[model samples]
Target: MTRVKISRVTKVPASEAPPASGECPPSGIRLTTDDGDAAMGLRVVGIHLENCGKQDYSVDGYPLLELMDKDLSPVQGISIVQGSGGISTGTGFDEPARPLVLKPGESALSGLMWRNTTESGPTANIPYVRVRAKQGADPVTVTPQLDLGTTGKLAVRPWTRPSK
Candidate 1:
């Protein structure tokens, strides 16, 4: 779904390598990814959860994706629907999840729509995505390459507080 490239994420640009910006992982939170945005076929990716570590940091729902494949393993059949369970329709990803708390440096926002459009079989170019800012929290691998042409499905949008 990234054959269009629109780009638009003002922050979350702190990187030190760890597969590509997602370093802070001692429960401090810091996952970045936003070089994604396509049009007509829908495909937006933006997952920046930054807390820099100090104290307060919480999450509510939908931030536990897997889909890895640049030698990171874990890619099986896709299908990670949470908000836009309807595939896609107006962008907001169907909208629903609410509950967050980041302090220290504060920053929270999540998203990952999909559509890619293909018609045959076999097509899920996910370069890596191991995020997990919920349910036990502690697993960030950021790098939303995801092309998912066959449309295996991947729509997550929760954890707000980033209208930039």
Candidate 2:
């Protein structure tokens, strides 16, 4: 099966992620929503992944999204991975999956939140993110690749700045 890379972005101020200690799914990734405390004042309005596609794959080894700072650097974060062609509860997004085989025009949507790890300060500045799909040598059929994230339709009030 052919493997491809998937990508996405978020423009809103990311909220702190809930602890992963007892919050993950048995089979899939775990995501906790910590609507940032009053200290940082960083509120996660919403996270939108536009067009997401994965090749024919299995649910065992799905791709994971790693958030980055304004410099296109990696920011420690957690991702919500799920299967393809399914609806994710709470948020109206698609479940991310592995070896995901998509027909033409099919896509998935993944949600994410940033957690505050630094002591007494604002959270990291997250502009864009990189989602890497691990590869496995399996005979599983796959689908065509699609784009992901806020496809140029982002609006972050009071936080928007000119791109570098």
Instruction: State candidate 2's TM-score.
Output: 0.31
Quantify all predictions' global Cα lDDT against the true fold. 0.76, 0.30
Over the stretch 1-164, how does candidate 1's per-residue lDDT look in tens digits? Answer: 55876663222213422333544656677777778889888788888888988999878867887777767778888888888878767767666788787888889888898888899998888877877778776666777777979989888888788877
TM-score each candidate.
0.33, 0.31
As for candidate 1, its clashing pairs are none
Q: How many pairs of residues collide in model 1? A: 0
Q: Which stretches of candidate 2 lie over 4 Å from their true place?
A: 1-62, 76-100, 114-119, 133-164
> Across residues 53-159, which tens digit of lDDT does each residue of candidate 2 receive?
23232222334444455544554432333421222233322322234433322333233322233455343345444433233321111111111232211111111
